[model samples]
Target: MSEHPIPDAPQRRTPGDEFVQALARGLEVITSFDAEHATMTLSDVSKRTGLSRATCRRLLLTLVELGYVRTDGKAFTLTPQVLKLGTAYLAGLGLPQVAHPHLEKLSAALGESTSCAVLDGTDIVYVARCSTRRLMTVGITVGTRFPAHATSMGRVLLAAERDLALPETLPALTAHTVTDPDVLRAELVQVREQGYAVVTQELELGLRSIAVPVRTSDGKIPAAINVSLPMNSPLDPLDRLDQVQATARAIAEDLDHLH
Candidate 1:
C-alpha cells in the first residue's frame, strides 16, 4: 500500500477560530512532507497543501528559520529538528515499546512482516513494525501511514467502534480498490462483527493482510496488529491467522498491564 501524511483536522465552529487558523496552516505545511516527498519546492508545497505559493513560501521560510527545515535556495528538506515532533508523540505513547517484542516474535514465527498500527484521523500510522522482507514497494517501518479504507489494519481500527468519517471519494490505489463508500462501510461493519479483517489485493496486487484488534482490558480498542504477505489466499484463512490473533491478544494484555 502507498503511504500518505496525516490529513488536516476537520473544521469546526470554534470560539476563537481566527487565533488558531495560522497555527493550523503551519501544521498542515509540516505534515505535507513525507517519505515519498522529502524535498519540495515552494510550488510543490503549494500544490500539495492547496495553499497559495506566497503563503506556502512564508510558512516554509518560517520553518527554515526555526530550524525545522533547510533550503538549498530552490528546494527545501526537513532538518533533524523535525523528528522532535514525531518523537515527542512516540515518547508519550508506550504502545510501540509494549508491542515491539511481540511483533518481532510474530514476524519470526510467521516468516512475514508484522506491524501494529493505530488510527490517526483518516490514516493508520504504524507505531511498531517487524519486517521480514519487502512485500511491497513501500517498506514497512514505524511512522508509516496507509489509507485506512484500503488496509486490513485500517479496517480493523475503523471497525473497532464509532462510524468512520470517510472521504467523499476513495482514491483507487489498484484495480481492485473499493472506491465505493457504501461498500467500504459494509466491509467495516462485517469486520466489527467478525472481530478481524482480511484484505486481498485491495491496496496492491498480490499483497494480502490479516488484522485483528488489540484491545485493552476494559474492552477499548486502541490499535490493531497485522501479518502481511505477498500471495493471495481464501477469504477465511483462519488457520495461519491464528498466530496474528495470539500475538495481538498478548500485546493487548501487555498494554493493559502497562496502563
Candidate 2:
C-alpha cells in the first residue's frame, strides 16, 4: 500500500499525576493495528498514533517484550494476545450473552446471517452473529469489522450520529462501493429519512444487507442490528425488516436495564 497520513490524535487532557499518559499511549499503539492494517512499519505506527518515532518505537518494543506485538524486523503486527483486551470488555458487557439468542432466532427465521454491531470509529465491529449457513467467502465473527461507509449496519449507525462528516476520500472496497463522499452523504440522508439502510454489493459482489438502529431508552443508538444475504436470495431485506426491527428493539430494551 502507498503511504497514507493517519488521522489526528485525540486531544490530550492532563488531569493529574495519577493519569498515566504512558499507559494510555501504549494502548493507543495497540489500537493502531487492525484488519486493514494488520501489519505496519514503525513509521506507519508512528503516523497512525501521532506519537514520535522514539515514543512509538518504545511502545512497540514494550508490547513486543510483553508478547502483545510481533515484528519480523521490518513490519510489526499485533499478536492474538491483543484480543484479550477486547474479550475482557465483551465479557464484562455480556453483549454476546444478551444478543446471541436473538441473532440465532433471527437467522433461523430469515435463513440468513444476523448480526449485532457497534460503531468503532469509521468501522462497525460485529459483537454477535448467527448464520443459518455459510454465506460468504469470509465468515462473520464476533470481532469482524467492516468499513462503515460500505455497509448497511454502518450507514444505519452513521445516520444516527448527530452531525455526520465525511472525509474527501473514501476507500473503494468494490466497484459498486460509493467512493464519492458527497454521494455517500446523500445516501446517509436517505437512510435517516427511511429509518433503515439497505446496501447492495458495496462491500462484496452478491452481498446485500439491511440494518436498523438499536436505540436505548435515552434514544441513543449505541449499536445496530443487521441481516445479510446474497443478492439472489429468495427473501428481500424489506421482507424481514419487521422481525429484525422487533428483535433489535427487544435487545435494546434489555440492554437499557442490563447496562
Candidate 3:
C-alpha cells in the first residue's frame, strides 16, 4: 500500500482572518436592522449593507433561526432576545459593574441624574443610569437613545473622535439645538481641548448636563459619563459642572486601573 502524504499543519488564527471576517459581516447584518429600519426586506438589507440580496437573506435567516431575529411574511426585524448579547457584554464589563455604586452615591449626593453611555453610531445609548427623581416630562430610561450632537455625553464622546467630523446640518431636535455644522464643529474642537462638555437645554427644555470621557487603562476614551440636572434647580450651574467633570474623571481613572 502506498504511504499517505503527511497532512499540512493548520494555520494559527490571527486578529484578521476569514472566520473573523465572516463573523463581523454577520454581526454587521444583524446590527444594520434598528428601531427605524426594524422590518426590512432583503433588498433593503442589501442596500443598507451593500451586500448582495442572497448574502443578506442567508444571514437574516440564520439570525432568525438563532432567535436573534424574527421575520413575518416579507419583513425581518430583530427580536427582544437579541438584547441578551449586549446584556452579556455589559455584565462582563467590570467598569460599569464597579462604577454603579459610585454613580448612585453621586446622584444621591447631588440630587441629580447620572448615566454612563457609549457612542453608537451618531447616537449615545445609556448603558447605566442613576436617576434621583422623576423630574422630566420626557422619560429617560436605561437603553434610551439620544442624538450625540445635541447632548453633553455625545459631545464628550464626539470630542474624542479623532479629527472630529461634525455634519454641516444636524437633525434639529429642538429650536435651541445647533443645526449649523461649522458652529458645531467649532464647539466640538473646544470640547476636545477642554476635556469635557456642557450643554444647557439643548436636548430638552429645563435639562442641563455635563459630561467627560471615560478613558481606558491605555488612555483610550471608549465612552462618557454624565450628570444631568434640572435647569431651574437651585444648584449653582458652574459649580455643578465643575463637580460633575471632576467626578467623571475620577470614575474614569478608577475604570482605567480596573481595566
Candidate 4:
C-alpha cells in the first residue's frame, strides 16, 4: 500500500480570504500521513508537507485536540477518527451502494475477484471490491492502492484521460511490468482502441487483471472496474471481457439513474 500523496487538482480560484490557507494547510498535514509514513515526527511532517515547524506543530496540536491525530509524545499517527472523513465522502457519492451489488454479481459470474477504483494522482485507489479468495501477497481492500502504470484498472483510467501524466521514471513492480515510457504509451493506445486493458503479472507475480472504464450516461469515465485472477487460472481474461464490460456498464447506468 505504499503510495505517493494524492496530488492537488488545479484550482481556478486564487489565494484570497475566500480560500482558507490554514484549512488547506491543515488538510495537507493530514494527507501527509500515508501507509509509508503512517507515523512521523514533527520534522518529518514539516518536511513532507513543506510547512514550517511552527505551522506544523500548531496544526498537529489542533488535530490532536480534535481527536484526528494521536501522538505518543514523539511520533504522531492518524487516529481512526480521520477515517470518518473518507467514509463521509464515499457515503456522499453513494458509489459503494451503487457499485457493490454489481461487483458481487460479476465476481460470482466469473468465479473471481472484482474491484473498482478511481485514479488518484499516480495511483489507483480501490473504492469497492468483491474478493473470492486471496490471490496476492497483500490483501486487497477498499482503500488499497497500486501504481497506475502497472495495473489494468490504472491503464484503463489513464487511457480515458486526454492528457496522461507519468513520472520521468516508472517503478517496475515485477519483471513483466512495462517501465519504458514509450512502450507504456503504445500499450495505452492499444487499450484505448480496444476499450479494455489487460495487465499480465505486472503488479505482482502470478497476478493478472483486465479492466474497462465505467462510463456514465454523459460518457464521462469517473472510475474503472477490473477482474483479477491468478496467471494459472483456466479462464481466459479476454473471453470474460464482455461480461466484465457489461457489468461495468450496468454499474454506470445504475449510478447515472441515481442523479
**Model 2 agreement with the true structure over 44-139: per-residue lDDT tens digits:** 898888889999999999999999999999899999998898898888877778888888888887788899998988888889988877766666
Evaluation by lDDT, superior candidate among 1 and 4: 4
Candidate 4 residue 251 C-alpha distance from true site, Å: 0.4
User: TM-scores, in order shown?
Assistant: 0.89, 0.77, 0.70, 0.84
Best candidate, lDDT-wise?
4
lDDT of 4 at 126: 92
Compared with the true structure, model 2 gives a TM-score of 0.77
What is the lDDT for 60 in model 4? 98
Candidate 3: list runs displaced more than 4 Å.
1-65, 69-80, 135-138
lDDT tens string, model 4, 9-117? Answer: 3233478868988898898899888776889999989888777889999999999999999999899999999989889978887777789999999999989999999
lDDT by residue (1-259, candidate 1, tens digit) is: 4575443333434647457767777887888888788899998888888788999889999999999989999999988898888888887778999999999898887777888999988779899998888878887678888888889999999887585678789988789888898999999999999889988888788898899999888999989998888774343446667788888899988877877
Q: With candidate 3 superimposed using the best TM-score fit, by how many Å does residue 213's alpha carbon deviate from the native?
A: 2.4
Task: Select the stronger candidate by TM-score from 1 and 3.
Answer: 1
lDDT of each: 0.84, 0.85, 0.76, 0.88
What TM-score number comes out for model 4?
A: 0.84
Task: Give the winner by TM-score.
Answer: 1
Supply the TM-score for candidate 1. 0.89
User: How would the candidate models be sorted by TM-score, starting from the highest?
Assistant: 1, 4, 2, 3
Compose the digit string of candidate 3's lDDT tens values, residues 54-79: 88888889998999888886988888
